[model samples]
Target: MGSLIDRVGIVTGSGRGIGKAIAEAMLHEGAKVVISDMNEELVKQTADELKQKGGQVLGLVCNVTVTESIEKMVETVVNSWGRIDILVNNAGITRDALFMRMTEEQWQAVIDTNLSSAFKVTKPVVKVMSKQREGRIINIASTSGVHGNFGQANYAAAKAGLVGFTKTIALEYASRNITCNAVAPGFIDTAMTQALSQDVVTKILDKVPLGRMGTPDDIAKAVLFFAGPGAYVTGQVLEVNGGLYT
Candidate 1:
């Protein structure tokens, strides 16, 4: 759909993984994307590769945990494009450990990156969006957050918090034409999951009814549903799992 044609959108952690997939999907449907990530080298590489496809993209170095970092990043985009239409809070990290063994720093880091980072970036973007009275904000959460898992206290907590935040913001801005939603993904083949042993991966999938892991494209498509579908869907969590939670 060219509904997003020539529009400016930003996806965090876009150097790779699901974030990259979302940006690519938007571009396929005709949207100019700003790739945001903390990794400068990876950002440039992804930007260059997308440009190879004739995608209009810009690399933005951002650390979502820091207010100034997000401030400067948003300012740069507004200065360049003059309008920010959609934002996907896909940047996150994990420090999996038992509750008894989890360090304060580990817990704090996960919360900052996964949860607070959404706030830090969304606050500014929402201001601009509210002014226009139309916008899309999609936050990437996890199935692990919905159904808590062992050794992932921090990750689960932060992701669950994001779902709550999404719902609240959606309600607060319902009349302003600003839609906020969350996408909870199950297993996806990415660098993070690849780090797990084959046995662990298999064990995890054994519980899924679909008998297979999901892909980044699976999550990306769900995100696109919220981005340009032009429906009044909001404050909802679309679980892109293999029917695991069902």
Candidate 2:
């Protein structure tokens, strides 16, 4: 519930889905938000739509897998906003296959997109945030990372890596007053999940004690907490999963 007036934030992969929800929530809190995605059209479209929320918005095309692309995105944000106050590493993908059937390409693709991108994106942001001595970093993780999933070895491993990375960042940046945390969402009804077969979706939802899937807003609110009033919290993994795991 803390006001983020004048704060500047960046939500990567924020053209749609949970990432877009996070950007909207930050805008609602009065933060200037940069919506970054690999898709130029989608990012521009989302930025235009979010302007109705009455906050400054910037749309940037960024391929998270490439270091040069990430550097440019960070440069643009800093040039426009002066400093970055919040960063949400929400760019991720899933290449699912049983371990026995998983290919090297699939494994590396998920790792590079989901796990490696964090290191690439955050490296430059950390420099600016450290100089300012104030910042928030929230990684979008998944329950599959916390509790292994059936056909998502690559995804689960990448998310699990995020959990560790979050802690390490918190420890490293504590002295500089930067907080790092992870939000592990469970069975959120995103376009990704909606694409699953009905039976598969039903089985996943059956495990949720809430008896329904979580919404993008559910995940967004959690990100907001860490960015705002939850500033004292660091090195924590908050499961926004409605009794699914806890």
For each candidate in turn, the TM-score is 0.97, 0.97
Q: Which digits, one per residue and each the tens of the lDDT, describe model 1 over residues 1-246?
A: 476887789999999999999999999989989999999998999999999999999898998899999999999998988888899999988888899999999999999999999999999999999998888999999998899988889999999999999999999988989999999999888887888889989888988899998989999999988998476799999999999882
The ten-residue window of minimal lDDT in model 2 covers: 1-10
Candidate 2 lDDT for residue 131: 98
For residues 176-244, write the lDDT of model 2, one tens digit per residue: 999999999998888888789999888877888989999999999999999994468999999988788
Report the Cα lDDT for residue 160, model 2. 98
Query: Where does candidate 1 have its weakest 10-residue lDDT segment?
Result: 1-10
